[model samples]
Each structure stands twice: as structure tokens, then as C-alpha cells.
Target: MRVAVLPCCLFSLAALAGCATGSKTSEVAQVRMVFPVQAPARPQCDAKPLERLALTGQVASQELIDQALHDSRAAHARVMRDDHVADASINPARLNLRVSVDNRIISSSCG
Candidate 1:
């Protein structure tokens, strides 16, 4: 009975080894490789139409607003009377004007 059991265990292990070594070609065929591409840089605000304004913390006035609009060639301008920049509602092609509570230009950005 012991001799018979030894042969059976050896056969089982041999079968498992055969199954483990069965195939690598199928796995290699199933895999694919990919490459990445670089993206273009965005244009700066100074290069656009709003370059004329003093920007950052400057006093906001009607004349300055008009000049910015004319220089930027934007369709229109919206003033946000907050100490911080507001959520973006303007079009990406338009200009975003951020102003302070005291009517000072906080900063300017192009959407």
C-alpha cells in the first residue's frame, strides 16, 4: 500500500509541473505597448489683450476698465467685487477681471 501511494503522489506532482510549464507564447501575444506625447504650452496673459493694465492691486476705475476691454479685444468684461478671485463663468476666449471690495484691481486672468 505504501509503494502504491508513493507512485500516485509522484504522478500527481509531475502532472502539475507539466501544466505549469504549458505556455508563454499566448501571454506574450496578448500584451501591447503604448507611448506618450507632449502637450503644447498655453499663451501668457501679458501676450494677450490685457497687457496694458497695471494689474495686481491697482485701483480700478472706469477708464482703466475701458482700456483693458479695448486692448484685450474681448467681447465683454465682468467685475467680481470680492477680495478673492471668483469662480470661472466667463468664456475661455474672454478676459476675467478680479477686483477688490475697495474697487482695486486684485488681479487679471485670461479664461
Candidate 2:
């Protein structure tokens, strides 16, 4: 009887170990965080035709700004795996992002 029980005990342990190694389903509550970004100040300029030149310059270089934003979003997603990026807004003042992040992993990632 002891020998029979030993086999049963070992089989239970093996089954438990398999369960431990499998993916765990966990509920992650809503996560919210605010990050302040200093918006770049618009260049000081007089209201004249020359302002058109500045505007043109800004428009032409907009691609760089867009690239920067793409990089930022990608980096944020990589760091916060549980949180999905809901929205991103950039005004003259700052960049604000609303992320549906996994609060469970946020603490571990320190984001």
C-alpha cells in the first residue's frame, strides 16, 4: 500500500508542476498614469509675409516630428506590454498619451 501511494504522490506532483509551468491567466485592473511633457515653444515671429517662410519651414520639417512620435509610441508599447496605447495627442504645450496598460506589469516595468 505504501508503494502504491508513493506512485500516486509522484504523479500528483508531476501534474502540479505542469500546471505551474503553463501560462497563467490573471486579471489586470485598469491602469492609469500621467506624464508631463514640456511642449516646444513656437518661434517668436512678426505677423507678416515672412511668417509664411517660417510656416513653410515648419511644414517641410513635419516629417521629422512625425518620426519622433512614432519612435516614442513604439518605445512606450515595448516597455508597457500590458497597456495598449489608446490615444496620443500633441499640442503646442505637450504630448499627452492615454494608454490602456496592464497595471499588473506596469509596476514591474517601473513605467
Candidate 3:
């Protein structure tokens, strides 16, 4: 059985060798496959601009908040009282504004 196996392998190798030996040079074949990838949509909901507006320590003016919301590119804006319980849900395209009891803007963020 071992002798038979050896002859079979040698025959296969010789047959393969003959397929390439007659040529001056053997050329290698290369196959390449490319897949198209799509990038995910990213929402711009940064709070830096809103924070800057709040740094004034004054009341959150409607005009200023509106401009900040527009600049932050948030689809919607929600204003919450500092002591009030706000919705804990996340919204990437929404701006959240927390105001103090005296109407001063305390914190600004995006959820």
C-alpha cells in the first residue's frame, strides 16, 4: 500500500511539472476581488458652541439658543429646567439645554 501511494504521488507531481516545464518562464495568475463599502451617516450634534453661549452666565436668550441650535446642526432643541427631570432618551440630532431656576443657561449637550 505504501509503495502504491509513493508511485501515485510521483505520477501526479510529474504530470504537474510537465504542464509548466516546457515554457521559458512560468507566469503567475493573480485574482483580486473588491467589495463596495458604504459609509455610515454621522450626525453633527456638538455642544461646544452651545457651551460657549452659556459661558456668559446670563439667561438663555431665545435668539442665541436658536442660533446655537442651527450652528450645531441639531434637528431639534429641548430646553429643560435645571431641577426638572428631562427625558433620558438619546437623540443624536437633538440639542439639550438645561437652564437654572433663574433662567440662566447652566449646561448644554447633545444626547
Candidate 4:
């Protein structure tokens, strides 16, 4: 027991000493925004073509939804399920689809 305890105590002291030595170091946080990164231009979506695929109040399949998104040229798709909060910010290339818990599409619109 004494042999084991001595090694553990020595290791604990060494670990504490290591931590204390590292504390004396200093780091400078520098952020250089030489040129702000620019995002690619997003095209405006046309929900009309997407609405044609709308079988409202019915379950929306992933493939069907994907096709609609492609037709509308929407950059992003927001599917709002029951009790799921969605961001209100509008994106011209985004497609908003309100659905029930079972993936039934309630309403589809492009922002």
C-alpha cells in the first residue's frame, strides 16, 4: 500500500507542477479580416412550379419535396413539423413547408 500511495502522490504533485508551469504562458488573440468572405449569389425561387406538385394535407415524401425544391430553385428548404419552431427570417431562395407530425405538407411557399 505504501509503495502504491507514494507513486500516486508523487504523480499528483508532478501533474500539479505541470499545470502551474503552463499558467505562466500568454497568448494574444488576433483576428484579421483582410477581406470579408462573400457568399455566392442566390437566385429567387418561383413557388408556382413547386405548388403544382402540392397535394396539400397529404404526406410529403422526401423525393417529392426534393423535386419541388429543384423546380423552384430554392437554395434551402425549411420543413416545420408540429411544435417545431422555425426562423422567421426570409430568404429569397428558401422554400418553407409547414407539415404535420406525420410529414404531411400543410403549406409550401418560397421566401
- Measured against the true structure, the TM-scores of the candidates, in listed sequence, are 0.48, 0.23, 0.56, 0.57
* Residue 27 CA displacement from its true place in model 2, Å: 8.9
Error of 1 at 87 (Å): 4.8
Best by lDDT: 4
In candidate 1, stretches whose alpha carbon ends up further than 4 angstroms from where it belongs are 1-47, 83-87
Worst 10 residues of 4 by lDDT: 25-34
Candidate 4 wrong stretches, greater than 4 Å: 1-41
Residue-wise C-alpha lDDT for candidate 2, range 1-105, written one tens digit per residue: 999999999999999987766634221121212444568755331223322233222322345334423433323222222345533332332222222232222
TM-score head-to-head 2 vs 4, winner = 4
What are the RMSD figures for all models against the true structure?
A: 11.3, 20.2, 10.6, 12.6
Poorest 10 consecutive residues by lDDT, candidate 1? 42-51
Which RMSD does model 3 reach against the true structure? 10.6
Against the correct fold, how does model 1 do in TM-score?
0.48
Worst 10 residues of 3 by lDDT: 24-33
lDDT of 1 at 41: 56
- Ranking of predictions according to TM-score: 4, 3, 1, 2
